[model samples]
Target: MSPAAAPRVSVRLPGHRQMALGLARQRLAIGILVFIAFTGLLGFRLIELSLFDGPVQRARPAVANPNIRAEIVDRNGVTLASSFEAYALAARPRDIMGNKEALIAALIRILPERPPEAIRSAIYHDGKFRYITRRILPEQAEAIRRLGEPGLTLEREAERLYPHVGLAAHLVGYTGIDGRGEGGIERAFEQRLTDPAQLEKPLALALDVRVQQALESELKAQMDLQQASGAAGVVMDVHSGEVLALASLPAFDSNRPGGLVGMPSHMNRATLGVYELGSTFKAFTIAMAMDTGVLPRMDERFPTTPIAVGRQRISDSHPKGYPLTVPETLIYSSNVATAKMAERMGRQRQEAFLRQLGMMDRAPGELLETGRPLTPAPNNWGLASVLTIGFGHGIAVTPLHLATAYSALVNGGIYRPATFLKVPEGAERPGRRVFQESTSHALNGMLRLAVLDGTGRQADADGYRVGGKTGTAEKVLEHGRGYDKRRNITTFAGAFPMDNPRYVVIAMVDDPTVGSRMAGSVAGPVFKKVVNRIAPVLGVAPDTSGASEPDIRMFEGLYKPRDPKRDPNAMRRAAAGLPPLEGGVR
Candidate 1:
């Protein structure tokens, strides 16, 4: 109140001064609002960068997420296929700031795999951007970064790695440039591998790494020894239909799949390459006869003399001048007897039996590379077709098909589709019945006899009670010039511990040049070696006493003992520049 009284006599402030004061106040208020808005915008930008924008996104290139692809492992947790973070070298040609020559030199030094001229040409290409390389190592990226080239940018990317390399290449497959699976297991389970829910869970295959290694090594060794054009093999659990090992040659590396496009070596012969798997089918014919009661007695006899069907004359490779019993027919691998068995079954019944055994369709399994069986059309399937198919010549199928069929035949007549997944213990899959249990048992005994005294003598492992059949089919000449007498596709399909069948193995060699070229000579040894190597790893204890062997006394006097001097494998050993076998026919 005292101050108001003192100012009462004074005049009011000038209008310009009052206006200046109002303007100052307004300016102060506007400054605070501007400051607050700027602060909010800066905070929002920081949050967006921190949460959504990182090195991968800022690179502005398509990059695969390593975490998206689930690791692939064997049943024992041995890593087969995996994915990892890597770097790619990309360029913005228009944005070049450093010396072009220097940059090119640096790139050449960093990546010796890339051609020097390629780098130079890429830099000079008329384009806004280019990828110098993709899936480069971190060390390479760092080396290139030291060049300080403004045009060059290193991008984070996902690289699919096959730690085992070509070990299980065909089974694990490979991812494409975009990181999507393209073949094998990778393609078969693309959805599962890429699913977010399953990313953390590894895909465990039925394959045992040790078993697979042994199989591949032995198969490859045989292929090299025989100088064969190609080879295929399969090891499967007879009871559960689980494929423990599948191999094909010449094998390509999974890590370097880029060069494998359209190459025959890239083919998965185990599942994709079809061949006339010769005498392996004889087992099926004999089993069919037994199951249908067409041949009720094991001693039922048929002439081994060459038989004529239409215009085709079928003869055994090593002909016997006399008739052979049903069991002896399989033991000697006589085509004439097998043909007669099919003739008795009739074409209709033979076709029906094969259909039930899955010989009329593609092999059922987890592989997308499975080949459809090549069989005579129903309308064209005549008696001749039946006879030849019975001997395994008229029908073409993958090695996997024979393996699966053999598994069914030996696994107590149950037919289960082959699988690559690790089945839980004590939880076997349900299967359909393909043969009577008695029929299977009888066939097992006859096959054991074959290994003991006939064509598969070389296929026996010391303590495994190995039993198998050998097949030798002439390859049709290029351009359909009829079958070539010199070139053969030889195969051996068999099971071990025949008394309680556990595994089926199929091995095939195409056009072997260095051996006798017969299945017993070329392919039988592969089976023997594989069984001996993998049996111990698979927990199959050796039975040195033959206590667990199948009884073959049913054919006691039905056939003559095989002569050691006539062994087909003798010619193979001689041709390979090796000494003759000291223990012949073993």
Candidate 2:
């Protein structure tokens, strides 16, 4: 056929057929445009997911970032626990483009702590993704990125950090592998700390770092000096019930809590370990006697003879053989006299007062590690229980329990629950009245007299008007055989600037093997040292002029100052350059 000249093949159609053919061509064009548009969209999405977002991020929705935690700070705004941005080494084995052996060696060099087998498995993982190591340092992340392997990647993550490692470990607590709080205030406030709406807000505790440091340092020093197995200390605001400092010996580092697993260091002795705090309870007994109107006068006398109730005989550690006045009974720490007072109040009145003081229940606070007090079962509480528990035996309560009770006894008799959260300045938490204001006033003088002429003399910091009670209770034998005489827990619970009590401080030492092993010599000195350091920090000014001394006129003629020469241990203590013990182990 000739090219264009001979070939003129054309066909004509009717109007309806022509219309149909044109419509078909238009529909075909539109379908091609739509397919092209859909193909472009799919390609763009693949690039966005693989290149921009990265595979690591694609899997992040399944895992929560541990660093999404709020900081924890002391009352003074000092950082205690915080979260910091860190990097994690991850891998996508299917996308590996480098020598697997070389990559494994490089990773092993970067993170020696990670097992070589783990690294190799992660690189050759038969899965979409795997995590090689988390919480990697920036330098290490940079090193890994320098390897330039397509499969290897660094993912953004977060890590918890405690700057002052063991400062308040038992109180601040540590996080677990899943970034959740496990103990102390951490577990107590886990919800608030991890809430997405409150992530940026810090958890401010009532602890003052200065006070905490001083308390922990002094307690540790005394624990070591006394050759004691353990120690615990607490400093709380008398009026506000805010715990300024709480220390438990053998503290573990919050940053690495696993190092001391199975050891007693992790136990918060101040809050979680309960003990029968001996003669310190005498203060409560005396107050109870006065509050219940059982004793009309502080000068009323109680015979110091041993009293027998059931099979148990109650005697004084330092018995003043002659008849002694009420003031004399406490000054002497006479168990017989204290038991006699308890006999007058009876068990019902005693239990009621203790319940009012929060002694019959678990110590109330923010911490989850709080100890449940071990008291005699209500059905089994008998005369023996009454007599012994009167002077802090039979019933076991935490040091925090005693601290909170002591605060009530001295702080105008208001029983406020102890708190770790910072109470705003000029604000006071409402409290229940446990003792009459007049009774509290009387206790202030009695406690002062105790420090001046009784078993707590070693605790008196000059000019600080420190007034507290000494407790030296024999520990109960394991399995409840009997109290061990050779082993005792020494404690001193008191408040400073007694004329107008501001803070209550308690120090306890477990099983001291050094010196006298008495509360006066062991725990008393601890209280004294802690007071000397914290009084000024807590805004309690020193007044050595006796101007701030409580009015102790009612107790003036009740007892006489011990003639140092008459003290049996005076000669030995002076020879050893130690303070004279007024009533050893009472």
Candidate 3:
């Protein structure tokens, strides 16, 4: 209230006004700072989105991964393929700072899949970018990200996933680190698989998962039981040429090719390894002869006595002195009769016939792998070659070739290429004629007779009307000359529901030891098991006679034996016209 105080107050601004001005200054300073920050951020964003567009990335541009779309399904619309999200850790080796040893130690400690040495080599590679590892675990990738290393980058990628694991390993095959097909259906149709449009659509295979599993299950069990070296099997629709089931032992895991022992495991023996597939080839020979009009009736007689050519002798595994009929020859697998039958067929007719059966060449199917047929040329194929090859000697062929051939000979004489993909009706390629329908029918009867009365009884499945031949081929020696009799390839190539002949199943074991048992004892049981399971799936009615049933014929004899001169000169002349006799029958 004093005069001096009033004068001072008049000179000063109001407290409230002063306070308001101070508040404004504070807000203006904050606003300016905020504007500068926002401008800088907007400029940075503009440079990133515009200048670095496709190349610069927050998460590494997905690394050009196929960005796998959904998988393909079968005709039944079952999921055969799908994709899973994965992470790939990579680094610019030049930029990786900290001691190389330390980083590798850290990586090795965390990711043990790759050896420390391997990781070091990869990390130090001379490149702009190199993958440290792919399909990284989320937690692990997150841990790496938290390390905040500028040199290392974690990329988001989509990888092809086979949900069933090994369920369809051979059927679907698998992809490599890069999205490329490696084998089986995957490799066979790599181009189609990589096609984006095809990826959207489902890939249907002819395989029945159930049948495949069953076949594998039985085969694996038998293999272990017999302690066999390797096993292979196939179930094909005779009518459609669709492979319902095909499997090979020492089968590698598609998820990881290196998971197997070696390249040997990758080889598809069913389609690749050529062998002198013993008696099973007799079916084709007889069929060829019959079709050529050179084969006599099943009742026609052949020389049961041993036939000699040079120093080599053609003798039956189960020989008889009396002349054997055509059916008897097949039933007993008489080497003499079959060889004689080949002589009757002669070279021109035999070679022509075999070529007709797709025997003188290779057959490439839908597999990335292919099979090579080992047939002596007509010039090299002398009398001996004809006889030897006629009985499945002198030359070798893959089990698939024989299977396809047998399928043709029995399935109304139409040899359809076996397929893994589900083929639409009428889409199958028609094969060259190998035999007459009549020959096929007769073959069916003989095969039935074989199961009932011959070496192939083990192939019979009650109601399935199974017909086939059993072959025990000795393995070729490593050194060259003779066959290693101790190591044998036991095979049974047969068809079931013989009357209808819907599917053909082939079972083969490589170097199967004659343990305490023989081929018939070891491989035969496996054959029985496979047929029992697959028959019903094929809609083949059970033979009223269980699998143990045999066809016993009480029939009249076909020919009267000629009581002629036992001429040694005639036999010596026969011996002159035989194979090279160099390679032993395996």
Q: Can you give the TM-score per candidate against the true fold? A: 0.85, 0.82, 0.78
How close is each model in CA RMSD to the real structure?
8.7, 7.1, 12.4
* lDDT, candidate 2, 1-586, per-residue tens: 6676786778765697889989999999999999999999999999876764444333322324544788999999999999988887888888898789988998999898899999999998887678887788888889888888998878786678999999989899998755778888888988788877788889899999999999999888988887889999999999999999899988988988875666989889999999989999999998998999999987778888888887888888887688888877777798988888998999999999999999988987999998998988989898898889889999899999999999999999999999999999999799999899999988887787788888988888988888899999999999896899999999999997888899999999999998898999999988999999988887888865555567665554567767534232343345456675445321
1 against 3, candidate with superior TM-score: 1
Tens digits of lDDT, candidate 3, 399-491:
777777778877899977777778786775667666788878777767766666677666656555677887777777889567886777888
User: For model 1, how does the per-residue alpha-carbon lDDT over 445-511 read when each residue is reduced to its tens digit?
Assistant: 7888799788998898977888999999999778964699999999999998887899999989988
- For each candidate in the order shown, give its overall lDDT on alpha carbons: 0.84, 0.86, 0.71
Query: How many clashes in candidate 1?
Result: 0
**Model 1, C-alpha of 351: deviation from truth (Å):** 1.3
- Show pairs that collide, candidate 1: none
Ranked by lDDT from best down, the candidates are 2, 1, 3
Is candidate 2 or 3 superior in TM-score? Answer: 2
